[model samples]
Target: MRIAFVSFETVYHRDTETSQRFRTVCELFAARGHDVNCYCAGFWAGEESAFERNGVTYHAVSSGTEARSSFLLRLPFVLATASPDVIHASAQPSSQVLAASWGSTLARAPLVLEWYGDDGVSDTRWSRLATGRPGRIVTPSELVGTWVREIGADGDIVDTVPNPIDCERIHRVEPGEAVDVIYARRLDEGANLESLLLGLAELRGRDWSAKVVGDGPERETYERLARDLRIEDRVTFVGDLDLEERIAAYRGAHVFAQTADHCVFPTEMLWALAAGCVGIVEYHANSSAHELVEGWDRGFRTTSEDELAEAILAAGDLEHREYDEAFAEYDRSAVADRYLELYRTLQEAQGLL
Candidate 1:
């Protein structure tokens, strides 16, 4: 099948989780012997038009200093020219989805909108796409599926598929003497880093250290909070790591901690668990991460600061268990197979299969 994957930004940028996830899906599709073409904005390398990377074709829709949003105007032409069997686009930059809608109509290809949580579903374009000009809407989780339905998406076409991870890329590694705790997330608004820091501070009497990974606008504030808690000596702020380093950090840690108010799908926690790190999520109302870890015996959902501190203290003595078998449902291959199945289903619906 000839597949055209659309996004607002180039996957090479790899700046957002959407880019990384979309790249993984594209590569998997290519590996599975499907012809994959990606249409994205040309924000990098000035005026380049088309190129191939990692076995997938990338078509940049813009060249000049025009804002990335301008890609919407050019997307129809790119989609028409590509004439793919299916136009697989993400529901972001809502304008991209809007353009894909227009282009899919012109090209007479089925539009498969992959909705990664509720990022921009409230927008008018998304609402229009959800209710009008029928297409397949793929959601990553039940939480997101429910959200899409609530926002007027066609219930018949909304499909749920979990986010995929490269399980082979994750493995356990022995940690040093100290009980290593890992917290990785963009340090920005709504990060809720203070709760994690305070919880760690409560465990000062225990033999534990932490590595705070990721960089953002709120890094300095978090660093200052760590100092204020007086646990700065034991916590090291190792901002922003590559994929390999992130997996290594997860594997090398005794426990992986997250205290977020909400999450669409907690990929980092899933990765950390797959890497043999004990998981602990501070329960917050409507938090999606809590759904993944609540029932897993090796993980816990703490509702209060005291509970979070207690869980961290108990993690030191909990026997480490192999998580590969438990995490097989989220394996990259499994997710790719599901996506392929969905694509075939869409094709069959259109009498192409």
Candidate 2:
């Protein structure tokens, strides 16, 4: 399969979750022997129009990351020249989707938009028009899929393909020292750590300890909150950790609590669940974290701090596990297969397969 990805700014240009997700899937597709080419503003050093790394080829639509109008104008012609079987694109800077649409039409390829919905993308006239242009829209969660539908995209064309997890790594890493509770995510304004802190404060008399496994601008604020709550002694603020360290923490922890106020997909929570932690998610209007725990036996969904506290306590009764096989479907390979399936379906529909 020849796959073309269109994103003016990639993970190299900006290290946002949406960018990382796009690059991860692109590399995964390339690893599976698909011919993958990414069209973006070049981020590599030197004066090269194209660069190859990690089994993927990246073509520069612009020499550097500047002048959005120039990138938009060049992208369509560049994509048409590549002539890939399918065109995958990021949904930010929605005008790019429109440009990709023109390119897909010229290249006689199907266009699939990956919409993470976490970047606070505002709806402009161009974005509203672009929403309806993609042949298919892929979101990480149904919550995001629904958002796409509301913003003029056809619901019939929207599908949810979750973020992938490295299941083998989870199985390989040994559990770290055991703890009663765990919370992991960047401590940004949306972290909502207070929910978990308040919940834990209620259970102060209980013999429980927690580890916060991330760092961000709001880390000090959360640390101060823990101190004020007087649970600082029990909660350890172990800033951001590498994947292995995080997996170890998840494996050793009995319960993993997610209280973020905004989340397109709960990637960390999924990791913890795969590590065998009983999941406790606080429901929020903008977050899809609760979607992961809805019907799972070892998962609990709470609407309030009291319910969150109760769920944490209830998780104590579940047997501790070092790894869970139920999340195998979300393994990186499996998720890549989902994208491949979608690509084939679209290609066949267009008589390109």
Candidate 3:
């Protein structure tokens, strides 16, 4: 099948979790001998107007020093070049999904809009209108799915597919390199990494190490807070590292601690599972963290500060979760298999199969 994956975000932004997820999906399809093309807004150096990377084709769209003012003008060229069977979109009603809608109409392709983040759905009112157009909407979790349902999308047209991870990259190593708990997020204040520091401070006598990976607007604040907590020596703010280092940290460490903003973000949840760490996720309203923790007995969840502290204290037993090899059946290969089935379903439903 000929598939065009569209994102308005520049390829410079492709290094992020959401973009990497899409890239994994594209590679999945490509590995199976499907024709795949990626359309991204170009902001990279000397990438041409458009080019193909690996087996996948990338069409570049121009922009000003600011936002994409030329998207309407550029849409015609992209759609004409990549006449595709499916236009699977990422994020909300940005130029990405809008281009998907336009491409579906002109190129006669089915549309699949994948929602990675909750901000557009949770904050903006305009998100309601442009999102209503796509042929199908896909979300990574029941939390986002429930929101889409509330927005009154056709129940059958919208479905849930967990975010894809490159399992090979996170494939496990030896017994372990260190006895530390890992917290890897953008380290922003609202993400509540400070509270994590406080909790760790409260447990300094436990003789545990904390490997904090990531840099953000709150790095200096978190560093100062760690120092004040007198746990700064134990906590290593290893600055920001690449994806490989992050995954290696997850593997080398004994546990995963994510006190995400109420755990509404699903990327960390998926990463925790993929990293083979027995995770302790934060619970809050609009959170699917508990959903990831449910029934698996492979992970734990806590919301309160006391509960988080307790989890931190007990994070040493990362192996007791009885590593679910059964769940490994749902890894990238399994997910890609499912997506191929979905694509074939689309083809057969349209009698093109």
Reference-based TM-score of each model: 0.85, 0.97, 0.82
Best by TM-score: 2
Predicted candidate 3 versus true structure: per-residue lDDT over 1-353, tens digit per residue: 88888776633564655666677778778887889887767655684776666577776665432456566457646776678877787764355566567777787677777776545364345456556767677776778777777766677877777766666555653333564677877866556787677777778887888888888998899899888889988888898877666766666666677776644445654665666677777776766667777776657788776787888667665463213354465577788877767766766676665
Candidate 3: residue 260 Cα off by (Å): 1.9
Q: What value does the lDDT take at residue 115 in candidate 1?
A: 78
Worst 10 residues of 1 by lDDT: 170-179
lDDT of 3 at 314: 72
RMSD of each: 3.2, 1.2, 3.5
> Deviation in angstroms for 189 in model 1?
2.7
Task: Give a tens-digit lDDT track for model 2, residues 1-353.
Answer: 89999888999899999999999989998888999999998899988888998988999898877778889999999889888999999998888999999999999999999998887445678767878888889999998888777768788899999999999999899899899999999888899999999999999998999999899999999899999999999999999899999999999999999999999999999999999999999999899999998889999999899999999989999999989999999999999999989999999999986
What TM-score does prediction 3 earn? 0.82
Q: Which pairs of residues have clashing backbones in candidate 1?
A: none
Candidate 3 lDDT at 158 equals 74
Identify the superior model by TM-score, candidate 1 or candidate 2: 2
Model 2 clash pairs are none
Count of clashing residue pairs in every prediction: 0, 0, 0
